[model samples]
Target: MARYKNALTKYYVGDLEEKEANLRLAKWIQAVEDDTDEEVEEEAYYDGDGTPEEDVISVKKKYSFEGFYDNDDPAHRFIADLEFEVGEDRKIWFKQERTSGEILEGPATVTEPKVTGGEASEYQHFSFAIAWDRKPDISKSDDDAGGGVEG
Candidate 1:
């Protein structure tokens, strides 16, 4: 059996290859929750009672993580550049391999980034947030991750 650790997770910004990513120093990858919810309305009729109606209202999702600080890393640069994007047109992504050899990945938008360091503290990290519309997909490999994408 393979041991699991934060280092096993990989984060990629945009379409960049993993070689240029900084996930090697990852300390933690927090779970993201899709805020999408369903709306239900119940109306009383003058005659017999009726079943309540329901509707789904999709909402923005959120993803967060903490990793070693590396200003030169492309993922870090991509996250920093997101602050300057007025319309937030860019996308961020992440992938993690499970013991079963399955990979999880999806599209995301960076929402926040926090850098923390102190005197006598050699370990520093950059924690960031992202918005997602859909939950990531789990595949056997990167090439199979397109299950979430449609041609």
Candidate 2:
């Protein structure tokens, strides 16, 4: 078991190798998802009497700005597009050929959105452990070198 002195940090990310890179990418996605987004809430109020003297019951307004992309391939350019996007203009086109592994990039609002809807939601609580370049089973040239905090 590779022991880390502290939780995952950018400092240790430099050592990540191959598959581990993907794992780190996944973690970043999770962190992004956990972040909250800004939201706008609208509320209305009414009273039994027309005058303010009467009791008034109203709903408090709150908005959740939290937003997250629905996709299995976190590496997809959509996430990057959302970040680099100048404004929240919905118009955008994401042309991608997974089979050919080719992607053509364009402007966000300038282009039409090729992204679709009907993404399945993740239900119930789940736990995930990320693994990157962790072939602990395979022996390395410098076996103990950088296995943990110590090189």
Candidate 3:
């Protein structure tokens, strides 16, 4: 088995069309979390076993990110500006690159960053949530095109 370090993961934000050229790295990030949820419905039949069956009707994928605040970073700036955009159409492209070289890209709606905590000596930190507009695209890295491998 192969092991990968979380420190090597990269995150970016920008327009999807010019993703390669325009994407800005989310710098000084401390943590990235997956916040996916599912909605299910239960169905019970009159002439069947006593156990009820549950089916997943829908799924919602999201990410919760936490990091030190940096005013100079374009990605951070973009997230901060989202606070002012109140409409449902407010969305931006995001990409995640795993250490194993798999890429996850999509458009997502971001909530305004909220201050996680503050202290007299500690650096200011913030956290925000990102909800995917739809299912994201996942692709394997060029190096892994031929075979399946776990990182």
Candidate 4:
């Protein structure tokens, strides 16, 4: 059996061009949540059987990130700036590197960050969600390509 550490996962954000220089590492992230929602339709036919048929109409993916606020971090700055923008005119590229070495990249729309109000003893924190503009591109890791290596 193979085990992986969550700390090894990496996240990044950049311009739509996807240039290495423009990519900013989101190292300040303390937690991340990936969500997938499926839209389904269920129908019951008047056949002899009393069973309902279900079909998945669509799938939506979103990632929510929470972390300590760092004013100096470029990725943090970029996301903060978007809080003032309206609509989806501005979109950014997002990339995720899993501990298993698989990669997922895609264009996404970021939501405004919700800053938490804490006591003097607590650190400042912010959380936001990014929704994929379309289906993300996934690249298999070398281990997965060679054989069955759990990610």
Each prediction's RMSD to truth: 7.9, 20.2, 3.6, 3.7
Runs of candidate 3 with Cα error greater than 4 angstroms are 16-26, 46-48, 115-117, 145-151
lDDT of 3 by residue, 1-151 (tens): 5666565667777754554414454677788888888899998888878678899998788888888888777777777777667765457787777766688888777875664468879887878888777887898877654223335
The model with the greatest lDDT is 4
Weakest 10 consecutive residues, lDDT, candidate 3? 16-25
Query: What C-alpha lDDT, on a 0 to 100 scale, does residue 71 get in candidate 3?
Result: 74
Task: Put down candidate 1 lDDT per residue, 1-151, tens digits, no spaces.
Answer: 2345433344455543332223432333343333433445556565655655444455454546665656676556666566555443555565545434576566655666655565565655567776553676766864443333222
Query: Which residue ranges in model 4 land beyond 4 Å of their true spot?
Result: 17-25, 45-48, 141-151
Measured against the true structure, the TM-scores of the candidates, in listed sequence, are 0.51, 0.17, 0.78, 0.78
Number of the candidate with higher lDDT, 1 or 2: 1
How good is model 3 by TM-score?
Answer: 0.78
How far in Å is the alpha carbon of 96 misplaced in model 2?
Answer: 22
- Tell how far residue 45 is off in model 1, in angstroms: 19
Question: Which digits, one per residue and each the tens of the lDDT, describe model 4 over residues 90-115?
Answer: 58887877765687788888886765
Write down the lDDT of every candidate, Cα atoms only: 0.52, 0.27, 0.73, 0.73
Candidate 1, residue 149: the lDDT equals 20
